[model samples]
Target: MPAVTVANPLALPRVPEPNPLTGTERPVVSVTTAPKGFEGEGFPVRRAFAGVDLRALDPFVHMDQMGEVEYAPGEPKGTPWHPHRGFETVTYMIDGEMAHSDSHGGGGLIGGGDTQWMTAGSGILHIETPPEHLVASGGLFHGIQLWVNLPRARKFAVPRYQDITSDRVALLSSADGGALVRVIAGEVGGHAGPGSTYTPITLVHATLAPGATLTLPWRPDFNALVYALGGAGTAGAERRPLRAGQLAVYGPGGALTVAADPKQDSRTTALDVFILGGEPIREPVAMYGPFVMNSRTELAQAFEDYQAGRLGSIPAAHAEVRAATPDAD
Candidate 1:
């Protein structure tokens, strides 16, 4: 829950209130609970985008809320080396540490409020795992991994990586000072985050004090979604109920609303929500396993290219290290 925090939210810049006369409040389209599943070497995850239509999540292929669970020593796990194409993987760590390494020479350690954005435009091979120290000591692990689809034009763009530390996030407050908003990518109320994206999108993590409400100006053309990370809240003008593990998809509008309940469980004192939206791509999507393409033919080509080792080769040094580790398999 400590992705980012401040002693006094009132000190931050306030998001301007939308003009009531012209602003239209979005209505909730549907609310769905995420189903729990295992991912990447058996780490528990909540499939956040499960049961949601791709049209509603345009430009976003998939999302997973990685463990809010505590891991005992030596129990941490992560993905094995894998190849991806025609999409970008955004890994945001709210707590604990994850070590990332790729065949394209991108690597880093991201923890607590940090983010690793990797674009597998054409293709790339990568792996993510808990750092050695973290696996040895055991700790809390909570994070999100979102897959963003690339338009056909940019599907073969150069591979790139961006390491966004917590300090780079744009922090803002509600007019009443009851909420803290962290802008990870895209713009919110004119404040922009550090991460650059191929598609027009906004990603925000907001924490609301009990009984607090936050209304944000939103782009009318972009789709909207609000996910409860912890505690309870209501979304949209219609006041659709939302709780941890739930997702609320919103219909067309110029503004969005989320309000925390008056009381919350002792374990989580405030309402935490992850808000995201993007312009619809509106193109045919043919996705399988790790590749997202516009057609089945392209997906087949991607697989053939991967088999030919065109994506990338594992760094010799890292390969040797992994082979020597007890858990390399």
Candidate 2:
């Protein structure tokens, strides 16, 4: 839970409390526990979007809560080089280090509290793994990887990358200074985070002290979802029980609420949650392994292109073969 923190939340800007009379508080639609799964090179993950309807997720396609596990030396793992298209991959490191390299010359080391945003617009090839030193020493590795769906209009946009550090994120506090909210993208309470997105969305990481409640003003149009990273809490005005690895989807409203339990487990002193939402794409979704397109024909074309070495090649620095990203739309 070392994503980001302040010793004194009271000194930060506070989120205005929603008006009880005028603001409509979003109600919890459903709470689904994420099923555990292994991803990449056999690393454990919690499938955050499991059991949730894709229409509810809209602009979002997939999400994974990567290990809260401590890896012993030589146990660290990551994905091999892979191809992606028609979407963006957002990797947020919460308590570990990850090294990223791509054929487009977009590569960097993301430490705790940092984020790597890669748009596989038309297509791209990339690999993500634990840093050499981290792998050798064995350490804590925890993070989130989210796949955001690109609208049909932008599916062929040029691939781009952005590195967003924790310091660049917008920080705010609850009116009572009981919660610390980190806005990683989009606007919240007039505060905008540094991460740029093609979709109209908001990403927030909030931590609440025991017995604290945070009420946030949300856009009526953007769908809302809250996923608990750790600790216990209640979501929405009706107070649906929520805990780690659980995701709560909300109904339409002008605001939402999350309250931390008065008592927490010995491992965690507070409640941590990841809140995200976006304007629904509302288009037919045709997705397959590694590609998200609007039609099966397009998906087949993507696979053919990838097999023909059109997506991209492993950077020469990492592999013997160096190929430029193909100019295709």
Candidate 3:
């Protein structure tokens, strides 16, 4: 509700609109703000667009925007060893540093705009914690963890990891010079994103200059939407003025227009939007705890394996909890 004073606001913290975009409909936007995320005791998360319906986001089941909050010295904290199966996890770092380790003998370190894409195909035990140094010195922490669905076919695919550094991702500016898009998946401005996804999708982190507009196109079949990460602006034809922390769900898929520079009389000056979605994986979803499967039987096996030592555990020798990360390997 109030201005978020983070240590670094993304520096710290797309396109055009025309006719016959081919098999696409201009996106209609509606603003929803009752809730955009759940307040974790520590980190805040959006399990399903907060107040929006689950069908809107389809494949993305959970998305957490970890604290942009400044931590007291020795206060930064994060996830510990846990089991996951039948899905993939994507972590994008905005500020600060973190260490990751998983049961599959993978590990890495990411900080300042790096990304980690992990496929927990069959199952894996992993821990994601701030690097020991950060936890001790204490500093600002800001990051996002997105749970991407694995279709029934690849639910048991072999687990793998992809470490994408900041330079590797495609960062593009709009033709108007008012917006910047940091693409992680799919393509932007004719260039491809770095992260590889089992599900065909596009993920973008866009920042708009005040009043700058980006009208981008997506397959008519994809479910497209935008989340205002910070600041405010208007989306779609309704020109529905959205406040900070609002989710704007679009209809069909076509040219989606977003204006970050609110009109002369508006609240936020800059607009931060995280855009993502793709062809929906129309399948029954069966989930329990961290495991997401198509049926209960698979869910049961996931638990059995963990209890029986099938999913490896974090090594006892390391005092600093971390897993086999993509970058570190």
Candidate 4:
């Protein structure tokens, strides 16, 4: 078993009593519920934060929480080969296993607690599916995939992938053993996640015990939001109670604070949430299903290129992600 270490409390920078910097006082602004949308063939998900203001949410546009649903024997479903352009897709697994296959011959399987980050720069075709082993036996599958919009200048960059395993992710803990945060990107407690982003962003998956509190600072220039995934908790200065399935879209502020409901039984209480935000890319965004570009003309070109197979294809042998059963695999 891989060892999970607790981060040193002194390693993490303490939040200033009042931000010493000018124009940087973190506050609780507006909180929005992430509307649910049945996106992939497999899960019931919610868009934790919603808005179209490109400047306010520059590098970020879409976020979705994949099913924490358990699939019965032979009932698992997933997304087939699809096309994407002008953005990056990040898949973080919480339970079960999911595999990634792409037209450029890039593929990887991230089991529970792992992450896979893919960039469909100019364009790429890919499929994310449950491994054959799980699909065959039928077990629980859960995960989250986030679509990060790219700046025009970098939209045409080459497609790539970053496979980050759970063992490589950094863990930050509170001095009292109350809060534990998994840093997927950005630094926490003097350590960082393995993701390499084109756009600077902060992404942390945190779990707090009953009454546990954790505060972290962010780039004052970036926008931020928090999505509750488990139990109940409060965020920002307002202390609004955010339970599971609630997404808090915060207004401009500096640092963010969150704590789990302390009154609950500590043994069973768990508050899970994802804190994410990034610098905005203020530019014209023309989006069609699966294609995002600066203008309608570019979007049209993307569709045409994909139809013409310009984006490439996944090898027949490696395209499908069949379950990796002991004997069959």
Compared with the true structure, all predictions reach lDDT values of 0.90, 0.89, 0.72, 0.74
Query: What is the full ranking by lDDT, best candidate first?
Result: 1, 2, 4, 3
Positional deviation of residue 20's Cα in model 1 after best superposition, in angstroms: 3.1
Candidate 2 weakest lDDT stretch, 10 residues: 320-329
Cα lDDT of model 1 by residue, 38-83, tens digit? 9878899999999999999998989999989899999998888888
Best candidate (score: lDDT): 1
TM per candidate: 0.96, 0.96, 0.85, 0.87
Query: How much RMSD separates candidate 1 from the native structure?
Result: 2.8
lDDT of 2 by residue, 193-312 (tens): 898999999999999999999999888899999999999999987989999999999999989999999999999889999999999999888987788999999998998988888987
lDDT of 4 at 22: 36
For model 2 the TM-score comes to 0.96
Question: Quick one: ranking by TM-score, best first?
Answer: 1, 2, 4, 3
Count of backbone clashes, every candidate in sequence: 0, 0, 18, 8
Best by TM-score: 1
The digit string of per-residue lDDT tens for model 4 on 3-43 reads: 23345644643333334463354676656676777765645
Runs with alpha carbons beyond 4 Å of true place in candidate 3: 1-19, 23-25, 34-41, 44-48, 263-269, 319-329
What TM-score does model 1 achieve against the real structure? Answer: 0.96
